[model samples]
Target: MHFQYCPHCGKKAERKQIGDEGLIPYCTQCEVPLWDMFTTSIIAAVVNECGEIALLRQNYVSQTNHVCVAGIMKLGESAEETVIREVGEELGLKVKSVEFVKSYPYEKKEMLMLGFRAVAEKADFVLSGEVDAAEWVKLEDAPGLLREGSIAWQLVRAVKVIFDDHTLCSQFLRDYVDLPYMKGIRPEDIEDVSEQYVTLFAEERNSDRVKRVHVGGGSAPFFLVSLIEHKTAPDYNVCMQVFRYMVYIWETYEKEAESIQKGMAKREDFLYPPILPIIYYEGAKSWNVPRDFRSRIREGSIFEKYLPNFEYYLVPLRDYSNEMLMEKKDEISLVMMINKLQTAEDIVNFRQLPGKEIEEILKDSPEHLVNIIANVLRAFLLKMNVPVPETERLTDKVREKKMGELFENMEKMDIQAERRNTALEEQRADEANVRANEAEKQAAEERNRAEKEKKRADIAEENSIKLLVELCQDLGASMDAAMQSLRDKKDMTMEEAQKKVEIYWKEPTDIPEKKNSPNG
Candidate 1:
């Protein structure tokens, strides 16, 4: 949601240069950026086993022509779930299987519409109140009922091709291969003789096989195998896995030929299809695993001529930056951008992406894709602890385009956060000062106690000295005796003892606290 004021602190946002995103409306207080928001919905071309499509007459959408079963996606429901729920609610038919066709971006309504090819059992029309009428039309004639080149038409056409194996295979080859032979190949010229090889690792592998008819001067049509392996992490056995799958495909083709009693499996003239191996890695970690099947073999270089060598093409998502991804401006890139966000901070800061950049990313995207992306982003934000009300404010701010006010608001929030931080710091400093003052007062009290103890010791020494001299004089002993007593009792040097005796003998009457002495 584009923010004029920071939703967190209710302050105006500020335009600040944040990383590679350039200038963004940064909430200085909460330090969060506003994210883009959109509504998501689904439309489905409902088909039955009887080669007929269930079309609806909704006056709200189109009065004259019929429309597919469509409805807005509800919160907490996946796109597929929404399709199934809508089909059941609007046309009273339970969906058997749903195959995704493509997304349509309805920018006019600011919603994304995901198109699907839903298969349901043929039944009588049990219409909902919203639908005026519902009827089953043959698959071949279904497109003519809807407006040409419209979203519904395209979806039906795609479904028709998908149901017809020959047409779908030929269309896939034409779009995938760059060879000149593909130009002359028609839908009827292709055969759906694909013998898929499934393994325990099939969960990680998406393999497709199609046989193309020989055009102009060729002898017969040959099978073309394309293997697309999806990897979420680096694996050393990936080469072995590809090699095993390729071997299985070749073995299957050989057995089929041998069973038919036509082309000999071991014959030199026997033709085999080209096998293209591709590895699509979307892991966050670096892909450091060996790229070639030969790399897995010991001493592969020495036996290079005998050993098979082939490398898979790697498409790493981590190689693309946000700018580069936005430049691509496709559904894949949009999804990748969402995947690139890892941490909580990264998730929260996604809203800080520039509005112009978002517009450019979704510029030519289908109408349904906008809503899909919006739904995905909304889910991500909600899971990341973003508030519900803030998520609803997503409008194309790039069209309204207010940076100064946004920036000003964000700056004010930043100022408020800074002020709070400053206040907290000052309070801590004041507490520290109080602690220091208490310590100084304690030190002063200790010094006073020490001084009083020293004074008492001095007064006791004076009284003792005077008593020693008086005792010596009364006992008729010489000054030497007093000095000897002082030296023996006080452990003083001869000189110190003599000096003490002389001072006490001369000041015997001036002695302080004379009665307090032991021998007074």
Candidate 2:
């Protein structure tokens, strides 16, 4: 509430500078600054055993969009109390359990909305007089029924993703194995034995441990235990916590060997599995502390031999940008990218155009994985308290694939990429054909030029022979002169020279005829 007059003394307030608060309404009589006050409320996504949400239709809030059960906080009541009371009063159903989700600030209503996921057994909802109607909406259908950016939608989405730790862990491992840090850890090598260890560690810890066995060729299988912890805030004791968990896992293995392996626990041949501890931090603050357990101990160098030394792989989501995550082209990278969203614009932009990585995933990844990615995106957008068209589009993209349209899209993309490759090959072939044709044309031109030169040489030789014969006849020379000239100038043999002289010499006519008669 904004105070124009001091409530204590009913004196008119004046604007006064207060330290770091800047200008504030100050009353001279009370010597106090009046600050704006807002109400607090609780918003809950009531879920049942069948994984359906109880969405209520309230005309006052929104006629078209549905809302979750929400109510103003009462005096001397905690936020959890408000959730239970509101659910009981509004829906007349007992909340089996309640989990606190993220808080949302409703600026328009001047209220802070604390979101919760309240699970209840499926039963008929007893709607209050204020509610027009209430229906059980499937988890997948909640986003469509509620307003896109409303608190109700956001809460429902959060609840949908909260229980999906197994899927999340599997996806993380699949992507994590590809990183260079986990050297030689291939996807095929990861064998999840989580079920075997779940019962052993359930009493001591709640977080599930993903135990994978790496079976090498003709060798004993090695056990790799992965402990993944996600922190939204910095925890300095994380190293100690990881160390304790690692010890517990080893202890569990030892006990299992003792009970199941017939006295192998006490044997020297017994071995403990290697544990890989990883911390995934998405907090706004930087995690600048040391990751090694030895670093957490004071002056551990002196006692290094006696002390344990193990380091955790820290995956700080803030250290990577959206561009960096997009390069990974995996589901976990997409999750990290969504976690890095700082504004509604960023969320909307990503939803609208998720980049090439998403296309790669769509084209190559399995259908269930695509569906999981779509749900992850929807959950992220809803948790961010803003809705973009991309969430619905992505969800529909997955559903369309299930209905065969999505696979068609993938096939279309594959065909387009293949066509581009084929077109390049055809272009190369056409270029080669053009070069071959040019070479053939040049060769034909060269052959024709050689033929023309040969024909010219033949004509010149014929003209020279005719001129020589006429000259011999004019000079009154005999056929012997012509023969001698053929032998000397043409470099012909005696027989060849005689033949040439007889054929070309028109016999120096009458003069050659008299010389033969005289000789006879």
Candidate 3:
């Protein structure tokens, strides 16, 4: 009868008797031919003191009796970690510095066995529930105890070769030792902005006597005054008060004043009460005043604008002598001029002086006041030291051009940085591609080697079987019985078969000839 069914679909069908015995059916759904399958396992070769190696006897399965302490490598664990962990759990002892030994294919299953030699620090021979018993047997004797043609025997042979090489032992130690203090960020790269500011500035208790107010709502005025003072004298605190007062006046005038006249009229309304009352009492000069009134100046108040020009207003105090000018000048004359010049400059620069009031003050002022005013004007102009109004527009255009150049340079820098990064990325990708290609080539070579080895092994097995069958037939034995006997003997090969055949055919003792020894 011939049977019809789809193995891939798991569907049954009507059966028919088949003529040929060798014909096999393929799965309809997957179009795959049926084949045998097997699984892979890992084994560990654990060596201890007394020159003995530890081996495990499995509770179940035939070949399991010939295995070493081993288990399946769990997810997220390495082969070495698995071996160490398994040894501790199965033997109730700690394993140190596990090493990889060798791997090979066995029967239908592939075995990657690791051989670890640790000085059995402490061990309690408590048989694990899964293992019948554990034993520490001598290296040479291990082969006899272990099941023939098993992974355990393979592991023993690998360990013997590894232990004999002292260079291999040194390399193993170099790979596993933990070196001291190898990692962290460097100290100099750390930044603390807040601490930097605190360290740079000098700290002092600020008093409410004459608090300075800034015009632009920042510490910029303080920064400017500090910079200027720092250049002049290292310990110049006197200018601090002067700059504070100037800032206060500028800010007050900007906030409250409409023009020079109105600002002067409302001078008493200034927030700083002391300076406001003193400045208000020292009233400005009037144009309609009598000649006698202009001639007789007050002790503190001086009509500075009544002078000939701005430069004359800045005359030093030493020029006005006590003896020569006492009859003509009051003792307070120099002080009053200093105060007037300072106040006038402050008010004028702040745009607090009205146009009509300035013109009238100029017309009515005396010669001395005019001279001082001229000097003060010159000092103010020199202090500014700016280009003329027409030249300033050209200077601004030049500044804008320089700024554009700076921006262009900055953009170029950004472009160069981006290009460098792109180049670096391309280099990394090229390196990765090269590495991937090398790995693939190496893998292909390894696969080719394995296939070659497998083909050689199959040929050897076939050769052994054919030679044994022929020898058995010559000896007048049945083909089926010979094949069964060959299959039953593990590790049977063509070499072993030939040896047995020769030994069986040898005559009983026609005294064998001895070879000439080296000593003889």
Candidate 4:
């Protein structure tokens, strides 16, 4: 067994066991166990007088010959203290102050390394035994020399922070987080944190001042109210407050002011005064009004006659330049008015072009131009009640003329198609008649050839029968008997029998001479 000291508590730890692998230790004094004991180090990114950085060469197996500077933190020493002490001992250079940059967790040895920026008061090369060599290198070339996961890379990032513009960071924090938080709170109630900008509006004739109120509770119910005095009429002072409240309610609730200003605009109506303006003043917090008739009167005014004139008080802020506003004016105006309407039925809806038409439009337009058009159309369509997919405003007569032209083209196409089909049908009928005539001519020629062949066969048969009858007559047979024999024995026709009789007569038999005299 071997003994060790606890790095955290600095107490002698008893070695519980030792094996072929390693020794396991537990501290009896601190009542804690340490596993995988490792050393932690701090790396300083020291910049010299010439705006150059300091680097050290490594020789260990983990990182060989690559440049990095790191030293183990001594017991009971803070991370910053270790960096200052390490730079002095390693390079023999004095540093003025160490700025803590960041800490990175290294998994290889279960260690957390801290990186810091140290500015050198003076440069004196005094290399320690641990570092083979040290040199000042340019900041740009530092990344190439330093190994990944080394302290050198972290130092490069910290220096980049120093060189980066500060305004971008301020703007980023304000837009994403700070502005949203400030806007979330009621303007009058915001004086708790933003007291420098709050102000009171007083009556010109009387010293009595007006108040700003935050009514309702929870997330959805709250609103900000500002009171103002009537310029000429003293009795109408409360009425003026009602008017100001109407404006404030709409500006805050009805209008999507931020999105509209950003050029990606939308509109939504509120149950209370929908559109409210951002009022700028200084040093006023919380608003109060008469508890009895004034509050009831304000409520009644909102529900009764106040709804119709709400849009008249709504004013669009002129923060955007005229050119930008003109570019987005139709979209912004369309959205603003659509939201102001009591219901979707109040606004007129236009027929929208189909997707194919929209795609053709996009293909013809430039990328940026198309995107702006699409965004504007989308914002308008969102507020409208009807399913107007994509529509742009044009003169009514022009739209009607375009529709008429489209119908005319369709009618012409249909007529041309019908004429082409009729011509094709006529051609098909002519072809069919030609084929039928050729078939009939072939049949007639085949019938005539067959009749000629039958006539030639009849002539050959007559010659054969005559020769047989002549042979019989030469043997002294009677002509009449020979004819009757050929007819009966050979089944010959009458014309064949008569030819046989004539052939037998040429043989000069007694019966043949009597037959010729009687027949003549």
Candidate 5:
């Protein structure tokens, strides 16, 4: 069952033709069923009293690749029991408490993963033969270190959520202990992992006013780790700004690489990690933002080729449904749903939220829930100068229907506002176009003047050359000697070289020679 070849006879597997299951793989020589079985394993994000999560690097995985404590589940052991045993065996650390986080069906190794979150009283670590080293990463920093989107990576995300805010952690775990990403693999594998996953280096570039977010992960010697955040709404000028951010990151890495190349670094290490830009947008209207920089330029323009031609992964979250969200129910999806509720024309459209969306809300902290509810209410009353009601308004679960009236009223106001704003925006756009045209015209005129001046200069130089040639013929002197005599006798400037030709053109005459006595 561990491998394709029979353990008994070392013969390859063949299709066993029987039963409703189509072509079950089996070893004919040993007469045993391979049955497409996968190894069952347990992985845990162990947290210590200091609120730091435990991570380890295995002998197989490179030093840079760190993961949570993980190992095979021995026969006849519950997934929960395995979590305790594995932590003790692999890290020599005792887990006081362990909670099931999620499960994942790993296709790469053909293993079934049961994820857990464990807590310990101490921060000490004694790594085993399987683990090369262990690090206790702070909960906030754990997401940044985890291999983004990997099973271990995803588990750490769920565990860290509880560490960040304990109130909602249990409630969230109760409903979403089995994450949606692990569907059909196991009944207990589901979770959300967006908190602290983004590690931004260019902190100064973005201000607090801008709600910037990044989510990304990748592997190995030539690994690429990009800090990507989700952005919503359509911003026409956002492309150039986003491109600039990417350039800054690339340039930073390039500078580091250059240092290593030039022996400026103390170590002989060299690495240039790739960056990927991801845009996750969910707004009321469709994205009017240009997909590529070229799309913004006027069609058939001569300068099109000279303009920027870069592209990014634009995930239009508005296009997906809550059902789709169930399969990937996490912070990003929740954000998208919140945006959708703000946009729906009909209150019934709010039901587009996945069936278990309530569970998602209950799983988060009360403060978090309050914020979401408050935001929704505020989005509805954006036109009004309203003093937002206190958080207690969300106490009644039945208020969803009552909130429908508010949503409907907001839709009516939004429609009128949308029309007015659209017209005004169109007028402004036309004005901008007119100004651009005028500026272009001025630039063209300046270029035309410069071209004419250059032409005049060219003609003058040609005429002067012809005149000098004729002067040389009349003087019956070599051109070089005549020019040299003018410079040496009168100290003629190089600019007036042609002037000397003019003087030479006069009839050749013998003049009285005077000796320079006092001055010489």
Candidate 6:
């Protein structure tokens, strides 16, 4: 920038030319150097367990389809931390692990771009406001979505190299274990554990995955992690069924443990290891089921408090977002928030052009997330009584920049139609009142016109008295009769009235008959 005045001292600045630097401005009153400053930013390729690459669509920067998650590095933060924070802030996904890929000079923004590859456990995400859309694209489809030679593409290519090599894949997967959810569990402990540590009874299905988890550096125990989508009413039998599973796990594990103990494995010498059962519930409603075995016993029975209990950890998705899940930062929490709102219009708004209230939920949401929202909106519209366009039409409208105009027009038209439907009587009454007022005005105008003509006749008759008297004498009629004839035929002029009188001039019958014998 070329500054004409110094900000430090209120004095005019002068341009001083240096050897290679083009005319630099300086303040003569106080020494001040003017230089252009640019932002330092980071970009990265974040991948999930399935090897799908995550791409982000920026709010203001890119006019294209999508870009990798990027942001300015905060002061004193390392490039790796910046990448991890950017992914978490924008997409709401915790980066399990991250590795530096490369760096480049971004000429357009005049900033340095540090690239990295981050791995996340949960592929599902919530988006922030700065990101318009996001998507997880496979390596084959990335070419069309990513701008060639850009830092985002360069980082993604590096991630692809790491995925291709088998040795690197195992090493990275082992290193990238998520510690946030699995507290105190290290990558080395998993290596020491073995799979299929539990065998099921004949009636019980033995196909599911079972692992040996060592807790507190103690003897390894066989654990069964079951995901249950339970929806039925909770009963006393539910607890007993869990107890039955525990019995099977213990009975089956003891047989396997003895063989391993006989083989003299260095792991554990115990004859029977404990079988810990974990039940993860995925239900729409909250978990209000009995937690203690005693709760399922007879309420008033004397032995109710003494019964043995079998309880397991229950994790339900519905409980967290019921009240304060509006943070929009938690992926499942945001979904629960929407379910809490349960309004079609809100779903449309949250999916398309989401605002500040639910900021973090949509900051990093992908276009596919929008598609799911669209489906939800469509389902709600189908159930609503108001007029709604076809699903395809609505989808097309929401996908473009003209959605605001289309929504406004739809609301306006709906309001107008509703008014027209409900106010027919009022409109008709108003029209009839206007027409009656107009008819009364026309009648009053006609009466005024008649009076005006009478007045004009009085003036014309007064002005024509001399002519009328002469004409009456010529026509052999009384002046009153001649005047009566003129008044009766008011459409004629004075002369025409006299001519008409000459045609009807007859001595009044009411007057005494005049004798005509003298003239004979």
**lDDT, candidate 2, at 247:** 77
Candidate 5 whole-model C-alpha lDDT, 0 to 1: 0.55
Over the stretch 194-252, how does candidate 3's per-residue lDDT look in tens digits? 11121112121111112121223332221111111101112223234333444454555
lDDT per residue (tens digit) for residues 1-520 in model 6: 3467787786887887755887888776787665555678888788765557788877597787578888998999876678778898999998765655568787567888877666676567799988888888764345457775467765654442322222222222232222233345433433211122222321232212233454456665435334232222344455655666666656566656557666543355445555444443435455677676666667625786566655665544445434344442433343334333334444444444333444444456454443333333333333332344453465454334223232333332243444565467568877998898899999999999999999999888655654654566687777567766676645566667666556545544586877889768
What overall lDDT goes with each candidate model? 0.64, 0.68, 0.42, 0.46, 0.55, 0.55
Task: Quote the lDDT for 253 in model 4.
Answer: 39
lDDT of candidate 2 over 82-179, digit per residue (tens): 88899998999887556566799986688999887776788998988999989997777778888865778767766644223344455565555554
Worst 10 residues of 4 by lDDT: 191-200
Name the lDDT of candidate 1: 0.64
TM-score of each: 0.36, 0.49, 0.25, 0.27, 0.33, 0.30
lDDT of prediction 4:
0.46
Poorest 10 consecutive residues by lDDT, candidate 5: 207-216
Query: In model 1, which regions exceed 4 Å deviation?
Result: 1-195, 198-230, 255-261, 344-354, 360-364, 367-520
Better candidate number, 2 or 5, judged by TM-score: 2
| Candidate 1 vs candidate 3, lDDT winner | 1
- How well is each residue in 1-520 modelled by candidate 1, as lDDT tens digits? 3678887789888898878888888788898875545688888999775558898888988978988998898889877788879999988998766656679987657778888777688998778899999999876556558875567876775553221344434543453344677666666776544323323122322333324465644665554443422346787887776676567667777887899886597788887655555465667899998798778989988888899988865657678676666664445555556656555444334556564666565566544344444444444333333444543333122122321122222111233444567679779988998999899999999999999999999999878877987798788888999899888887889999888887777534665664666865
Question: Over the stretch 289-309, how does candidate 5's per-residue lDDT look in tens digits?
Answer: 766767656782567778767
Instruction: Provide the lowest-lDDT 10-residue window in model 1.
Output: 403-412
lDDT of 6: 0.55
List runs of model 6 lying over 4 Å from the truth: 1-33, 75-77, 158-160, 163-165, 168-520
Candidates ranked, most accurate by TM-score first: 2, 1, 5, 6, 4, 3
